[model samples]
Target chain A: MRYAFFPGCSLETTAWDFDRSVRAVCRTLGITLEDIPDWVCCGSTPAHTSNASLAVALPVMTLQKAKHMGCPVMTACASCYSRLRTANHKVCSDPDERQRAERVTGKPYDGSVEVRHVVDVLVNDFGLDNIRARVKRSLSGVRVASYYGCLLTRPPEIVAFDNPEHPSCMDDLFKAAGAEAVEWPYRTECCGAGLSMTEPDAVNRLGHKLVSMARQAGADCIAVACPLCQLNLDLRQADAAKAYGAVLPTPVLYVTQLLGLALGLSVGELGFNALTVSADSVLQRCEMVVSAGRGGRP
Target chain B: MENRLESTGTSFLDEVQRRSGTPISACFQCHKCSTGCPIGPEMDVLSSQIMRLIHLGEEKEVLESQGIWMCASCEACSTRCPMGIDIAGVMDTLRMMAVERKVAPPDARAKHFAHSFLQSVRHHGRVYEMGMLVAYKFRSRDFFTDMDKGPKMLMKKKLAFLPIRSGAASEVKEVFKRVEEEKEQ
Candidate 1:
């Protein structure tokens, strides 16, 4: 299957690995991801607070570009998916708003483009059975906490793919990738985004609680959808530890990275170097690689 | 604390009912939102206590509490709510209200940063990352903390030097003006 790919700004920088893994996995699955040209930021968190209309317009422009390509659009970032889906829903449901959106873009958006989250495309379009067939390495002892974060599921009507409260999209993906997905209470908690710089204490406090809870739930690593969540949980986790005077180490990974590993891609190919907390121990336990080898070998 | 009460006329109970849509009168002192709140453990005032304060018309306490600012806006309480109320929206409304009333949390950094972000967007028609960060530090008075990372970001070419202007900057301005006019009304 071929789809238009929108890798939002974060994926280009901090979550570069997510972009790499997404491309690698698409290749393995025989799917074509045509990059949307001249795409702007999806207006992640700022657009929603600053101007709701711009947030809607930003994604609509990308979707229109994708429609020109004549394919459904898929986003690697959860925030991108949420914003895109929100724009699509609003344009489809409200006629006046849709007209205004079209006037702004100089193009008609009749909700022709389908915006699917990476997890949704993998689980629903690719199917678990097909993904399982591609898994060369079985992640037997690796325990993962599938953290969905807020944007992917909240305001459920906009992102109608899963149940907002108890989402299992990541869990199903993890299992298909040969990893054990753990259940945790703070899976849907906010990572104190955008406020990480402004209100570091609040973010640290919140981040510590989430990491600690995931650890207490017996997770080896936390898997996430949003880049902001990954930043807070992995990057700021050290600062969060300083606040409580207790060092807690918990690595976070994108769901696509795990799938890439299962699909026989190497660590460098999956952007493992971008993560703050080292996943060496977790990877060691998975035994995809022998002590001497760099790449995963069956 | 008492002085904070004289500023806003909306009573806590009224605001809570308006924002949450749950009858604050029927709370029965239950702590469901608190218990189910994943971030409640880190909050200064538990979610249940915040709800109770709102029920009692303690607008000062409810609005001033760090609980409002600390909320992750995750909607856990709203989902687990026995009365099917939107507790997260209540917190968001309170936060927005607090900002409007200038009763902002002691840590005004987030508000200042948000304002800085908007200023850059309004002027350039898009967010100018370096300019926004510089404005944020100048406004918040914490310039040196991440000062080093700025150059690294620029060096890597990750930070956009030019603002990506929107097609409808003037229209967006009109929308903001309309909101301001509505506020005046």
Candidate 2:
């Protein structure tokens, strides 16, 4: 399968590892992902929160670029997927808003391009059976809490991807990769997002709740589908804990990284080293760790 | 807790409904949105209150409130609303109207950051985090907002020193100019 990739803004910097690992995993899975030339920002929370016209206009411009490629545009960032999908929904469904967006961007956007998240690409496109066939090492006995955060499934009419309240796409991927997916209540909860920067205290309180919940639920690690959730739960974990004298030691891994591990991709290839809380202990516990350059099956 | 009620005319509700494309008149103050809102405590005026205020035809106070600026837009309100109100979209429309009408915003830093973010996107066709930071710091005059965060991000290579342009930024700028000329209600 082939797709036009839209890496969005955060993937270029804060979430660079997500970008690399996504590319590496896609290549290994025989999925062709070509980049859209000169794609602009998806406007993220800033645009939609500021102005409706600008929000719709910004994403429509990029989707129009992908439309010419005649392929589905795969997005790794949850925020981008939400914004892009919302733009597509608005332009096609609301005639008057579509007219305003067309007038603003000075181009006709029929909102016909297909926008798919990489999580959807992996679960829906690749299928569990095909992915199970590629597992070189089993992630058995390792319990995982699949953190969907928001955007991946929210305002259901806009995302239309999975069960908004209880999504299982990431859980199914974890299971097929040989790990047990833990059932948790905060799977679809907000991770404080940009509020992490603007309102650190609120973010810490919320993040602490999520981290503490996952740990309490008996999961050794948390698997996230959004980069923001990964960063907040893993990177700024200290900030989350220092809030209420809590201990948050769970390792947060991208869903792709876990699958990449099962596929026997190297530690470096999966970018595990970049995560703040190292994934080494969990990998070792699950017996998925490989000695460098040995093509390990242990 | 009298609201100093204003006249219930003036097309404010219609304008908000038109801009957001949501059924503003359908909101009946179930307060389900307020209960589900995670940031409702942080907001001066809660999510349900904003809808209620608009319904009461109280535009001035609602537009000047900090609730719109503080909202995380997590969609808890939008998702749980009994009337299927796109409550978050109404927040966005209020923010836009607050800007275009030149009203004094309760949160100046957020407004400044929004402009800086758009400026960076307009120039580079993608976000240049460092450039956007500089633009924000210059405008807000608050260089120490995240005093050590920038350098730490730089050490981790999460913040670039130079711009990462798409080489076709002219196309993005064209879109920006056109959006500026948009005269839609």
Candidate closest to the true structure, highest lDDT: 2
Which candidate leads in TM-score?
2
Estimate the overall C-alpha local distance difference test score of candidate 1.
Answer: 0.73
The C-alpha stretches of model 1 lying farther than 4 A from their native spots are A95-107, A245-248, A288-298, B1-71, B81-107, B118-131, B144-185
RMSD of 2: 3.3
lDDT by residue for model 2 (A87-199), tens? 99989998977998888777898889999999999999999899999888888988999999888999899887799888999999989989999888899888888665566
TM-score of 2: 0.93
All models, DockQ values? 0.20, 0.61
Model 1 chain A worst lDDT run, 10 consecutive residues? A289-298
lDDT by residue (A80-112, candidate 1, tens digit) is: 887898789889988976986776666788986
Off by over 4 Å in 2: A288-298, B1-9, B104-108, B183-185
DockQ, candidate 1, comes to 0.20
